[model samples]
Target: MDDNADALDPTPTRGATRTRTALRRVPFTLGFLAVVFLLGLFTGGLWSRLDRRSWYPEIAYGWPPLTEGKFWTPVTGWVFGLTPGQYLCMAILFGASVAWAEWRLGTARTVLVCASGQLAGILVASVTVGLLAHTHLAWADRLAEVRDVGFTTAAISALAAVSATLRSPWRLRVRAALMAYVAITFLFESTFADLMHLIALAVWLPLGEKLFSRTEHGFWPRTRREVRMLAFTGLLVIAAASVAVYFFPGNSLLGPTGDERGSFWSTLLTVLVIAVVADQLRKGKRWAWWATIAYGVLHVTLTLILLGVAIGTDYATTGAVTVGTGLLWAGEVALLYGGRGAFRVPLRRKITEGALTGTEPGVAVRELLARYGGSTMSWMTTWPENKYWFPADGERYVAYQRHAGTVIALTDPVGPPDLLPDTIAAFTDRCEADGLVPCLFSTTAAVADIAGELGWRSAQIAEDTIVDLPALEFKGKAWQDIRSAINKATKEGIEFRLVELADEPFAVIAQVRAISEEWVGEKGLPEMGFTLGGVEEALDPAVRVGLAIDTKGIVHGVTSWLPVYGPGDEIRGWTLDVMRRRPDGFRPVIEFLIASSCQAFKEEGAEIVSLSGAPLARSTDTADTEPIDRLLEGLGAAMEPYYGFRSLHAFKAKFQPRHEPVFLCYRDEADLPRIGIALTKAYLPEVSAKDLIALGATGH
Candidate 1:
């Protein structure tokens, strides 16, 4: 036991040994950089006038070493104008640029990012370039992405991806800013830098670090999934780049004769670099600049082969072709593995809890998609339920789907283990031989656990909520307070008449939109009101509108409700959607709605009526819990502000409802980035980080 305990510890000192091992692996990277440096020096020559204005390209005869062909005349013709010293420095700079990332992530990890990032960047940039180039838009529109729509932009973009996926905070800010400046300097000053790198980084670090923190095996298949997504994305990128480059024209990309745009060395260089870079991506680096380089190679190779057959080549000029290919090979290789630890001296890694053991961002995406065509299992939108089996809140829809052989899905919060055992059995009996089984996206673990406890097979679908709405007994002091508030509203002439959804005073959709926008923005509140595809996402067919109108036909406040149900059960829920009262007296919309929903549901023989969760925006940024909680601690005592927690709790006090704590738990843990991305695309399509963090914390 003691030996096992000690082994599991892997103490700090033991962990430090790994760091030492990591440092030891630096030679591969150093050697690689050294080769680039010397060659750059050789080509740049020994000296020149010390002024800075003069700079030119040159060939380092041995740094990459010339190997073949008579294509030397044109290639050397451009290089002869440069001083050898200048060429060496430029090569050295490029090598150093490649080395920066290797120092941070550990050689293997760094190499992974470089290789994969390069392949991804190249392919993406190439396609984007090609698409923009070939579009029928005007020159201004075609060149809108950059002053020059060519492969150099693709190259920078590929590098940005490498840096974004692997660079640390400080390095990212500085390097990214520097990259932007250079890209702008060379391309279009007003462009958005073909920077897919930031996305790569966002996808890489958080997921990689989080997943890797788990036992290493949890990371394997997930990593494969990320690689797969990168591959698909790479192909898409190439198509976009192709359009951008070929259809656009700018002096920055024009190769002498502006007509030689797509035929330029720079464009070819960007595409060609892809093969070299993609070859280097290991770990996260494996997809490095793939599509971009592939496009370039295809274009250049075909052009050259056709040219050779048409015009013919002589052995004397072979040196030029060799130089061109060599410079390309060196840059591609150097940049391809251009990550922090790709060529680092090896150091033993430390295993500290919560410290990043590894990072595999978006690595889980494909694994999810492979199992399901999408990353999430939402309440709506799936063809499988029609093809498969799903239960809706409605029986007719369910019957129609079953009859039509369409997929239908449903969720049950909490009830008997066999809450739907009969339903599942019936479906199974109907489609037993075919393997199409009815699915239950359960709300409570107790419900799902029972299915498993009963020897029935099941899979976790989703998590939901239920409120234990007790009777509206006026026995308690708080319940009495709720009653009193309703009495006051009636006395003040605030009446509630339940109207059909279509008979509401204002346009339901437009009114909800205005209130929602205000709540999400200026109102310091948030809602899950289903802004898009209408309010039906969260509401049932029993929905009703309670408009608080005055004698003048003026709207004072508005509320909505519905009777929610379960097998052999039903309850009333008052949705306090929008409440704006005149200053003569603010109407207690909560009191009226609760009273209305209760009366309606009770008459229908429902046992209890739920006021529902306060639809206050709980998005992290808008949530005011911190200050309220702080007051509870008496931290830095002060005259309590009027509207803060002081007012919020006061309103809830009227209902005097029992507190039902809602906890947001995940499957061991949750993917925050995925959640954030998901939420932004959901409630607030324009949501920020605060939105995701808030949404991720949400529960019914």
Candidate 2:
């Protein structure tokens, strides 16, 4: 306990550097057990006999127990195994679990949890067996005769206790798996050891808080509503397993003698129950939570009554199994009752913590992007239409816009590469909470893989054309088209001029505006904006607008570029945005303007220039024949006649730029209709569906 202890906080507050805080003390628990195992190996079966000798007195709760005091059994039993295989198994589990637990909970808590779990589990299991045996229950004979001399009970319990210190959904997954294993073993295996494992779990789960609260953040299902959902989900899982055991002969504790038809129908009913209840739990339906609680109470009561009758009629061979099953049901019942307050939220409304940086989301995100920088779409986040979602640490952000009841994230999250997955999860969680479909739009293939890990699907939607400035030359045969356009513009006295649009003269601004208006007028629909910008966007002083102007000062073609930023405010390159031309002025005007812009950017120390991506335009790849690909292809075809995204892409290809595929990552295909509408709104915020359909029919 010193100033150094303060730095051991793994997830430090903002502005705190993450330091690798090593354990203050080495975990001696595993080392000590290794020594004992070695000692037992060298003792020629002496320690094994000593282990049996000590067990006789300690378990007084068992029948025919020794009167002589052998108080060391509880502690010594873990040290001496009857076989080398047993010792080796215990050693592996003990070493890994103890070391990890000690690192997280520290040495003292780890040792205390393990020791207390071991002693309490054995004593309680022995007592339960001994009481049943005194009453002459059929299956109780084996429990009093068995010597449970292993570290499994303690190790598993310690693992469970330490897991409470972990975060979700990993924590939820681990705890669920551990509970399932113990319950399944007790129901099917029906061994004294299985009972001991359950007892160990039961003992350690509630006692973990006393040992350590260092990792508790109260961010998970600690709420009353969440606890109730946990109860319902837990009960449903156990009920489903119980039904499976009943149907599958030889897997049941009753030794497979039940009626097959009865088990089959019951199992089917249980499965249906599980499906309904689980869905309800996920949706946070309070009525379903209450229904699950009612089911648990009725199920446990009926099982206990039937269990009593079976034992009374001497028909029960494994009464311990029945009792264990009853305990599992009763545990679910207690959990439901305890978490009754947790089921308050309705199906549509969800809870949220709001902004990650404790400031206005947009402002905080802008600051983050300015400091860290991002990919090509990063500048789009600064667009007035977008909102931001950040992870708990505020290290990254998912820039998104709301459309068609879906929260569509614009590209993948931008920030530290390592935090992308967690940031995606946090953003998705926020969307789910707000009752909106979550999706990632225009993400890269690598980013798609990250979303795929979260059970999302990806479809290639567009291809970005980027030119390597240093390697590009208009003199080559491949650049013939671009070369011709540039030479023709030069011969016609059309000069390439790069200027700050905001700093330009009023006449120049009026000319650029007229060219944009003329270009929109021919499209037969309203001017588009989201990922596509217009004159207003070009007016930013930081943006470099390149114009192809004739000697008489008439603007022939205009191209605006957004600075692709690198670290520390350095400009990496520029992305082409507003590319427009006066129809009567120049036929090869766009090509001339793009070629001139590239040369200017190249001369300014830029390495590459992105002609930008054409939305809904994808190159054919044999491997990418998914249903979404076809759907997007058809959609692209329908809009191509009017929007000409493909035509735009083909036009950009005249520069012979390298193409990079862009993807749309989403959670489910069912959201495609909404996603489609959202994408339309995002790209053409000013255009209406009626106008789009009219233009599509006209085929202009």
Candidate 3:
């Protein structure tokens, strides 16, 4: 929109101010719902007639009887102060409080949070309240009044509490104390409504962070079932109103119809309908179509019967009439229409974009921003966030690309999906120190978190994967086979040497680069796990380089290894960062490099040699899932036609390496869990520390 708006992007949008951004529902739904419920009770007849001041004493002991069984006869009493009115009010308020929440948090999460907080509140209420009060609810009463199906209380609690990492070590002491307080208060008094708040915080923050943090599907606006449920409630209101007027003639409905004073019933029905409709509208539904169709049919019938009478009907006014609203309410389910916005994925595009402001621009999609500040033209040389931040020790990297403007670099996944503005700015500042082109790639969105504190292009893109050496296994049949392969390579005129940083890294790298470039030419361009920069480009202090030359001193290829079991770091998986063979002796050369890499890994005591993947190693399995077996099977099946019949598998299978399968689970894919991240090479370029961290954190 406006330039200033772009600058102020990190700030949260205030929902109550307008149509309500998904994130802004907290104040209105959480706080405003409480206010309205209280008013509804006061106005809706909780104290319909309190002329006898003595009746006021009923307030002090209300909570105890309600949670108890016998006092709530027919399961309807003991609702408010053991009155149907109170139950109706509780239902209304509770529904309102959670409807928006369910909409915001998604179905599963909203239910989980609410159910948990409700249970926590109930149990804490039971133990504490039971300890203090003599009255206890019979099993029947407990079942009816507080049936423990899902989290009604906990959902409310979660809605109230805003912290996502409730179990974070730093927040543990406080979280524990809060949980204890929730237990105590629910036991002693009915006043504490913050348990749900705490649960809300505990459950929602992480979920929200995760949902939005998904480098893929977060940030799009769309409605979910929760919204539709609220919308459907409107049609129920209309149906219920029609029935109330038809049957309860003299109760307080419209004009008297027949017999007794059923007219007052109409008044109550109208209120119910109004409450439901208002709730639905606020939940963001254009119930206009259903509302119009439904009302049109019912009104036409009513008009024919009242042809001789005078009656005024307003679409807006009639919606307030309530009748047998249950079926109508239930029918709200058919109102599932927000699919367009909810599931609409944007078409993929290059991540970098432009804004004249000094700040990094927002991305169109979460594509890995090759660590360059957006300026459409500078896409090629930009690195992803991690690479930009490779030298984590506050050193800036500068570069001057022949085509783009001055290149100053910073390292961070700085904007929207990440928001690491300050880190980005600080990183670009490094250019002054290193004297290079300044740019930043927020490997992690941390860069965007501090945007307010910096003024630079904070935004960056993500790359598929980055190769890292320093960034696992078991021996059995697999081990014996690998040993044999290594032996075979040794007999094949292959020579291996480990360079502990000082051992002439380039002498070996030059030979490897030549072979690698030649391989690149044959395989096409842009090696998946490597850059054109070669072995020297792959070296750093945290890494150890190794070279495998032929007996003639012509380095056939290169291999890197790492300490598998460091006292400080439990390193297990060793990556095959670079392996290129001379075209003339490619097969024997590959076999030698492969065997040598495994040998070096074993020498260093590595458990598994991570050969990235056959396809994209990404899969749809959670960390807790048992997928290694299935992954191995799939790899065997797919590679059978190609790599399996070729030298790649011949070499790999000889190692008898236990296949480690990876999966990718998208919120959209129905069978996502079944989708394997077949091979990292297919999905990602190379692995980086950030990818490793995300693997641990998000379990993607």
Estimated TM-score for each candidate: 0.32, 0.48, 0.26
State the lDDT of candidate 1 residue by residue for 151-268, as single tens digits.
1222232234334343122223333344334532233211222333433343444444443322121111111212222333333333224334445533332111134335556666
Among these predictions, the greatest TM-score belongs to: 2
Candidate 3, residue 470: the lDDT equals 28
- The lDDT of each candidate is 0.36, 0.70, 0.38
Please give the lDDT score for candidate 2. 0.70
Model 2: per-residue lDDT, tens digit, 1-700?
Answer: 7777877856666544322233244346646675766767675433345344543345222223321355555666666555666676777877777778888777878878888888787778777777666455435665666565666877887888887776433454557678878877776666766788889988777666444434342223432223544666676667655575565533233443243324567668867877878677655466776787787678688778877787678664433434545667787767656544334333322214544534665567667776676667667766644666656566677777787899888876778778788888888888999899988888877789998998999888999888999876788787898889988988999999999999988989988876675455445444455577777678877689998889888998899998776666677888899998877898899888899989888888898898889988866763458888877777777878767998898888788888888889888889988998887766654454566687566543
Candidate whose lDDT is highest = 2
lDDT of 3 by residue, 171-240 (tens): 2223333443443333222232333334444554455446432212221111222233334444444444
